[model samples]
Target: MTNIAPPLVLTVAGSDSGGGAGIQADLKTMLAHGVHGMSVIAAVTAQNSRGVQGYWELPPEAVRAQLDSVLSDIGVHAVKTGMLASTALVETVAEVLAGAGAPVVVDPVGVSKHGDALLEPSAVDAVRTALLPVATVATPNLWEVEQLTGVKVVDEAGMREAAEAVKALGPRWALIKGGHLPGEPADLLFDGTREYRFTAPRHDNRHTHGTGCTLASAIASNLALGADVPDAVARAKEYVTGAIAAGFPLGTGIGPVDHGWRQRAALDQSRS
Candidate 1:
């Protein structure tokens, strides 16, 4: 008998003690996509459904060591990054990723779901100059779009401009998420000349934490499984839409989207 391995995906991000977002969400999403998930923790947060209280960033040397250890040994097929909390960490991760021979999904995480600051104010420039340039796909929500490029997306029409501004920052594809806009959730994907729009019915759930981290990891997983940039985003959108719709309450505040929604749905269908 022979044993086979699943596609490998790596996440470089912070840890959410609440287990609803950050590395936890990333790994759960990778597992849901049937991929081997690996992580390089860049920071750790004292966080929960209520909000982020505080965060501590790891040293650049520590982050670099983890990256080297993983890439030199169990190489990844795709990589996703989130919540690099400082300028040094951002630069360190970006430098190593510039040489990593895998598709990279860069989620420019600026703030938490409760509006707590995650990335340092000083790190914003590093993210724009160093990190975004090396990304295969940069997934920025409407807030992140403004943070990174000063492009505010108020309507669907404004998302194209946001996409173009993000594309100018050097990512091969810029996925400007328009979920914050006053309509059905929509995201625009652009690669200089071509464009793709993805939309899903809006779920009326406030417990939709971890949406960004989960979506980016799903995209990385799909890419590791050999989907092209557009297809990867499309697949990720569907998975996250289901998760958001199935979100549940927790911790007396906003809870997380169900990373295992697909599995639960399948089990229920089989039983019925």
Candidate 2:
């Protein structure tokens, strides 16, 4: 028999004890997309569906060692970063990923779904300077757009402006998510030239805990499988939209999107 290789997608992010976001969500998304997932934990958070109570950033050396061990061994085809809690951690991770030779998805995670701050104010400059330039695509929610590029997004026009502003920071492309915007949930994608709008009817659900991390990971997984930028984003949008729609009630507060919604559906179908 011929040897089989799994496409590896690496997540350099924090740990959400609740398993709704961060590394938990990233790994789940990779598995759902049929890719192997690896992780380099940057921070650990005492968090749950209710909110983040506390967090601790890991030492830069430890973070570096983890990245080195992975890249030197199992290797990675794509990378997605979330919750770089400090400037030091951001810089360290950037250095590790600088020559990764794989598509990088930077999700500028500023706050949690429950409004808890994850990225530090001091780290914003480091992320913009070190990571953004190396990213294949930078994914930022509207709040993160403002936090990273100082571009306040009030409407659709502002969203386009935010995407352009972020693209100017040297990333090949930028995705400005407008889920926080009122009315229809839409996300804008631009590469300093063409634009694509991804929209979905609002799910009217309060359980969207890990949507950002999930989307980025799905994009990374598709990219690892050789999909180009536009096709990767389009497929990722479809996967995440279905995840949000199939999200179930969990915990006492907010819950996670159903990363394995398709698996659950298949099981139901088999039972019929």
lDDT of 1: 0.96
- Top-scoring candidate (lDDT): 1
lDDT values of the candidates?
0.96, 0.93
What tens-digit string does per-residue lDDT give for candidate 1 at 97-202?
9999999999999999999999999999999999999999999999999988898878898989999999999999999988888878789999999999999999
Instruction: Give the TM-scores of the predictions, in the order they appear.
Output: 0.99, 0.98
How many clashing pairs per prediction, in order? 0, 0
Decoy 1 TM-score against native: 0.99
Model 2 over residues 90-150: C-alpha lDDT tens digits? 9999887889999999998989999999988888999899999989999999888888888
- The worst-scoring run of ten residues by lDDT in candidate 1 lies at 177-186
Candidate 1 residue spans exceeding 4 A from truth: none
